[model samples]
Target chain A: MSILVEISENLQRGKAKVVKELVQQAIDQGIPVEQILNEGLLSGMSIIGEKFKNNEVYVPEVLVAARAMNQGTQLLKPLMAAAGVKAVGKVCIGTVQGDLHDIGKNLVKMMLEGKGLEVVDLGTDVSAETFVNTAIEQNCQIICCSALLTTTMNVMEDVVKKATEAGIRDKVTIMIGGAPVSDDYCKKIGADIYTSDAASAADAAVNVCS
Target chain B: MIWTREQYIAHCNFEFTGREMFCELFGPLLQLEEEWRQQGASEKEIAMTAFDWDYVLKTGLPCRTGAVTGLKPIILEDTPDHTLSIDNMGRKSLLHKKAATIPLPLEYPVKTADDWLKIKHWYTFDESRIDYGAIESRKALRDKGYLTLFSFPGGFDEPRQLLGEEELCIAYYEDPELIQDMLETMADTAIKVMERVCDKVPLDNLCVHEDLAGKSGPLIGPAQVNEFVAPYYKKVWEAAKSFGAKIFSQDSDGNIEPVIDAFYDAGVNLFYPFEPAAGMDMVKTKQKYGKKFCIKGGIDKHVLRKEKEDIRKELEYKICDITKGGGTIFALDHRIPNGVSIENYRYYVNLGREMLGLPPIQGEGWQRMAF
Candidate 1:
């Protein structure tokens, strides 16, 4: 079987070890790094994301599959780097200021990374200044802010305002999400986008990045 | 006879007669500040503010119209400063710094057997920390009107916090003996703490806070709970009972149906904040547990943030359906997030009172209830 197909199968079954082994075999077999990534690991993750969106798989399953995909990616990273492969997009992400909750944020990050976005994670309790600065430093095309608390969600506006004040708002797309966050909130906050779930977020990120 | 807040709320509703009007109290945690910020709080920029204990004591209710206060040590330093970030899809992403403070057993606490031994000495019962004067004031306040003491830090999930999820999982198989020892130690400490606290204050009910489940299900399976959690809970419950505490309650977030039997077996007579995320149908739990258990806080926090009409509908559905048969108090399944407008919260509270047949919150006769 093709190495890409094997990697996809491993990911579907959540066999991290098998995925890792198969990726190594593919690399050893001289499969192009990008091909292995796109057709193998990324393809598998996309399927997992779809299943997650449909509720065919839940958090644990997603986490396990993500772990497997990550393992597979590890084998391909050096090869891809050597081949001068660039990330599909550069995205800056962080939990909004004053909010330290990260479970949802982490999941979204994993999914985004799985989708081949070069994510600049700003971590939890991120200040608006930090997000703006990171976006500039990373030359990011997208700025995503997460707030899990109603109190902290207000920071999304501040981050957007800061981006605007810095004259970087038009330069980058701003996205916000969390449990308390909604599309209405995103619109109200003047954010460019909002997604309720991680997979949707990843897909959205991919669309914007592309 | 000891009167619980549930009983008091019921009595004020005229569901019971002559039951004292003890107000329910929820302890504030530092985590709430982050939750509030995530919801878009703009007022306070500071972390680790103290909760207005005085305000809570004065009002006789857990409701407070001021800034929440609490101190939480940072646990993760290795992670970045941002709490939540969005991805390219405009989806918010979050990463908890490794430096973020975790519950003791779960993240920050004793990991190895040796670490346990070192920390064992710190667990000694400290009586001086017990504010007998405050307890006396609370009791006096109860006499004048009604007051309920907030729950302390004992619950099924507390030990898990101390044990850390990953290590605890490993300990279950790799080191059962150590796990048993840790549980025993926790039980001993819990019993001592309860005994000390109750000695100072006559508790109507003791709430044990633990988030045993997530949106999906319980963190630990039923068999593990039976083995690791039940015995320690029994110890705490027994200790509370000995001190004349009437209700031994647990506050766990998520659908706990899978472990409801374990809760009952552990002598947990009351359960609060039944999260609907795990498909928690309070009406079903009430039917299953019946009078054997008293439930509090089954209203969905998410729904409370909805439009008034929707909020009212949800309130009616939850309160009417869940409490229809009996043995339930209407409360938010969790803390009322800041996303829930104050107006909506008041609506919920007032609606709750109306449903319970309690007097209007603002009135001359309000002094009569004194809750």
Candidate 2:
């Protein structure tokens, strides 16, 4: 089998060490960096994302595969940069203000990255102004906001309002999610989108970016 | 309306009371206290009125069921809004004093087998860990007509304490042997502790907090739960049941419907705080599982944010039929969030209380029962 296929299969099995070694080996063999990324790393992650969507696999599988994908991608980062291979999309994501909960936020960020989006993680307890300013500064097309608390979800409305006040509401797609958010809430806040789970969020982001 | 322990036990087992047993299944969120104070109607006053009017109360038996007992959390850093602390499990967490959110786990203690080996000694049960006096006090607490429970962390929850949710999720696949060993050892310790507690005082309910699901479904589906979670539940629950514990209940915050059977089949008969926003159709759950399966909380909290009419519809949809034959307790799916008008909240409660045939919550001798 080709070395690229080895990286994909090893990453799927969560063999992080093996995947890292194979990614480096693929580089040494003069394999195109983009091929190793799209075919090797993202290919495996896309499958994991689909499995997660279908519940054929669970969180642990996705988590381990993400760890493996990270291992492989760390090797490809500078190479991809040198080749001038830009990300398909860029986004800034965070758990909204007054909410320290980040488990769901982090999971969504992973799924977003799995879809080949360059993510700027603003981390937990992030404010609306930060989400807006960072997205503009980083040239991001989408802004993702997450909150686990019902009380904290009010901040998501502020995120949309801030984006509108900053005159970028039409330019940036606002995506909202977390345990307390829903389709109705998305519509209520006038955000661009809301998906129930991380996999769907990633798919939605990719669709909007494309 | 003051049902004895006999009535509460009977109601849990699917016996119909004459009307809905007046109860609130979950506690108020501490984060909303400031809002409540601002509204000029504290839940404390509401709770006092609830009891004066014969509301059924619930509380837990104080039990130190952690891997290591008597180990206090050491504050690493203290700030105006948050405090960083490390516990016996060696996890570093940030506790927000002002925000009612849960402590965010920063650094996990157990990742690999070597880490498990290092912490294994803490889980061992000994005479020093036992508090016979506390057990006796629990018996007195139960005798006060509170729906008393002996609650502890479950298989998934205990390990989640050592490994944060993300790490624990990955560890299930990465380190099955370590997971199984930790669970089995914890179960052994749990069984040991429950055996002694049950021996001293008769058990009303034996509860294990799993918190193992989310908005989509259970974090792990039935197959993984069967392999990883249910076995320990089966063994430990059977031991507690053998000690005359009448109810084996599991507490999970999100949609547990997927693995509910796994827990039910493993001897757990009751569940709580079922979040309706997460798609836990409690009425459907009741129809599917029948009267033998018990539930505590299923009222949609989002309704409390809507019109008074919407609140009535949501409550009637949740409370009416499900409570008809018993095995159900009415409560908001989760905590009352900030911004729900005090008027709306009181309306929801008094309306529910009236539906249950309890006196209005307008305090002593006030006759605004149908406002």
Candidate 3:
């Protein structure tokens, strides 16, 4: 019956309206914004993320849970800003060039955002230079690339090369993922990380950013 | 030597499904036709060439129905530039000009049971259009010695596409009846169209295009598939068979391992273009369901871009074992993209022939029968 647990449970159930109401109530009760964010919304989302990674839940569950998280995040954003609190990390993500598939990329973006990360969604068919330049320009701590096709997965290599050329290769962790991408391909491309699913990608992004 | 139709059919166990060559790539295929003629290759010598219902079907129902209802697919946007448009299926999609193969669906028309009811009205078969002449036209193709393969929309892919994947997946739990209603509507239209086609001409084979999987596996898990897709498939398959459908198959893009058995039991005896990138293993699949179900595509299309030897190695594994008893067909898991040079494709095809103890196709790049 604890306030945070209630928020977490409501968020997990994808009762976005309920989660938002509880968050506002908790705020009125003088609960710390950071605690509500980390313990309530993000905690619920992290569980959903793990379940998604484990294949116990699928995309729709993750999407609705993330929606609830977003509802709670919106109510807390003004307070967090007023309190001088900041997002955990900033990252840039996109589907690689020649690959127009964005469902996987969008899923990863939502998961990262649910984890309290500021994600700059570069969208699908993004060039390697866009990813590299955006990372440098935005001071992103990580560059995440996704590709759904084997033919376009090589574009991830170009992204790594672009980051290296931009001279932020060491500063920004490069994460590659999608159906055809593998750990071997990640290593071959010299990317820092590769995760099979969106949740793991988000989990890795958090680690890389921190 | 040119092979006879019976020998070719026996060699591959009637595993041939027609091509889905991109609209743009049709030019290249036509050009290849001229080159093929110059090289002394007869019409029958070209295995990929075929005339089928997908190209001629008037009512786009059961196969890409966006254009069938007399609605021109308004190009809401142009491609390679995130061209957004409402496709023929009353679904909004972000289509790319370069990759015109599959569009990313953004909005779906049917989500709730109410939505399903409204959309069901759009799936009407025009009896005037479905007259005996429709079958007569196809029968003419069959009379020309071309094997007549017919296809209709499998109930699942059409409704899933109409409802978008996310909504459809969630609807399985939230509105299972809505899913059933939409599927039943789809089967109704399919049975009517297919019955007309079957009543007119003997169907040599049937392909139900269901791109219902991601790279990993079925978008919806096996249980949902059994509950939602299986019965609809059984209904359509039985209707198609009653008229005279010899070979039945499902044309899905991604790994279908979860629903492979379910599809086989539903009378879809063949699964085509088994995408290797999606973890579809021909060797393993054949080892398990080879006797009951035949497979068509397993060669990873990406391998064709690699060195010739790499392409050979990719084909070598499946050529002998899978195709030993005419239970498998040699094809890219999906369409051969423009990225795959004509030379590579010709090489792959000739290599398949060489392995099958058939004569190799002789040509060079941009030359007769080459890229």
Candidate 4:
């Protein structure tokens, strides 16, 4: 197999240290940085994401693969910056107010970064005002809200309403997901999208950003 | 005839305890109690008739079951709506003080082998950790038909509490030694502590709790279960089983359907609060496992937020054959969320009990779980 395929396989198996070493080797061999990133790192993570959605792999596997991808990508950051390769889009994400749970939120953030988008993690218990202000100031194309509580999920609507009032509703896409979030609820709250799992959420965000 | 907590467990194991029984593994959200009071319930009425909680009695034996016993969280910051605290285990979390939601974990206790070594001292079995007086009282209660449970952190859950979710999963692959040490220390600690408890009184239910699954399935699969969990779990569980823990039970949330065999193979004969939204069906599970295993919760908890007719429909379909078939303790899949009002909740309990042919409730729906 090719060196790029080797890096992808190692990453999928969660061999972070090995993936880093192999990525550096590929870099030294004069492979294009974007090719190494797209073929070596993101390609592996994309497969993990698909596996995660289909239950072929689970949280642990997905998390480690994400970690490995991050490891491989860390080596390419400077080179990519020199080459002026830009991210597809930027997004801001958080768990909504009164809901402190963040496992799902963090997973989606990693998947977003895996999809070559810059994600500003606002952390948990984020209010609607903060989400809107952050998106406005950061010039993000998408805002993602997550809540794990039935009580706290109502805050997603406030986020939607705030974006509308702030006049960014038309400018930025809104994404929502968590244990209690649904496509029907997303529509009811006037949010743009709701995907069931992290991979699908990343895929949806890519769609919105593009 | 009324039966001991032991007998109730026995009946669920297909051992036939004179009569079939109706019980639950959990209670209302307790945060919803304030709302219940606002909905015209007197404080006295609420206390006396706490959804008939004791009617289908399952009393957990007051033994020290946490990673480290008797350590309260140290307050670091106090806001009007949230609190930032470091738990005794040295994990930092942000709490939504008013809402009573699970605190968002900001930092975990263990990150590396050195971190595990720094904290390993806390896992030892100390005499002070055992609650002797509470154990004596609950032990007496157990013999008098209250199902007494000897509950502890499951092998997977113990390490997860120390390592946090993300690190724990990665540690299973990258730092196998750290995971093994954590699991081994916990298993040894469990055995030593449980031996002392069993010497005082026999345990009816050996309850291992691991909130290890999600809407998708278990965080770790059967392969991980066999690799990281089962070997140590088997040691502690078998010791409890040998010590007269009639039912080896586990409590996990979200689609545990996939890993039931891993748990069963490790000697768990009973499970609780099987989430329906996550695809756990009582009828299908019964068809598969028959009466060999016991299931406590499967009724859709989300349905309680809806109208009475919806609640009735959910119950009628889920419980028609579950209760009569044996090896079952009827309950909602999880706690009652705050969205469910007192009136709707009472209707659920009363209507649920009536459907199971259990005793009905008193006026104003302040009755307990038992008749």
Name the candidate that leads on TM-score: 4
Interface RMSD of candidate number 3: 3.2
Q: Where does candidate 1 chain A have its weakest 10-residue lDDT segment?
A: A54-63
Off by over 4 Å in 4: A82-84, B1-3, B15-25, B42-62, B69-73, B101-105, B131-139, B362-371
Binned by DockQ into CAPRI classes (incorrect, acceptable, medium, high), candidate 4 is medium
Compared with the true structure, what per-residue lDDT tens digits does model 1 show for residues B229-301?
A: 7877787678777776666668777656777887789887777677664468777777666567777666677
Write candidate 4's Cα lDDT for A93-206 as tens digits.
999988877788988998898888999999988999999999999999999999877778899999999999999999999999887677878999999998878888999989
Model 2: residues with Cα > 4 Å off, grouped in runs: A1-13, A17-33, A82-84, B31-63, B76-80, B87-90, B134-148, B357-371
* Candidate 1 CAPRI assessment class: incorrect
Please say which candidate is ahead in DockQ: 3 or 4. Answer: 4
Question: Measured against the native two-chain assembly using Cα atoms, what DockQ does each of the candidate structures obtain, in the order listed?
Answer: 0.08, 0.58, 0.31, 0.58
Using all chains and alpha carbons, the TM-scores for the candidates as numbered come to 0.64, 0.89, 0.78, 0.91
| Candidate 4 or 1, higher DockQ | 4
RMSD of model 1 against the true structure: 9.5
Tens digit of lDDT per residue, candidate 3, span A1-210? 988999998877777888999999999999999999999998899888877666566665766778888899889988998887798899999988867777778888989988889999998889999999999899999999998765577789999888888889889899988877778789998999988777778888888767
| Candidate ordering by TM-score (highest first) | 4, 2, 3, 1
lDDT of 4 by residue, B1-371 (tens): 23456667666687655444544445556467777788986675445344543233667656675667346889899888788888776678878876665776687777779978987878767877677777788777766777666776677888878888878888888889898887788777788878888777776778788878877677888878888888877988888888887787787887787788888888888887788866788778988888768887788888898899999998888776645646876777876677787788778877877877666644322222211
Is 2 or 4 the stronger prediction by lDDT? Answer: 4
Per-residue lDDT for A50-163 in model 1, tens only? Answer: 876665554545666778888988777777878988899999889877666666677788789889999998887789999999999879999989875555678899998999
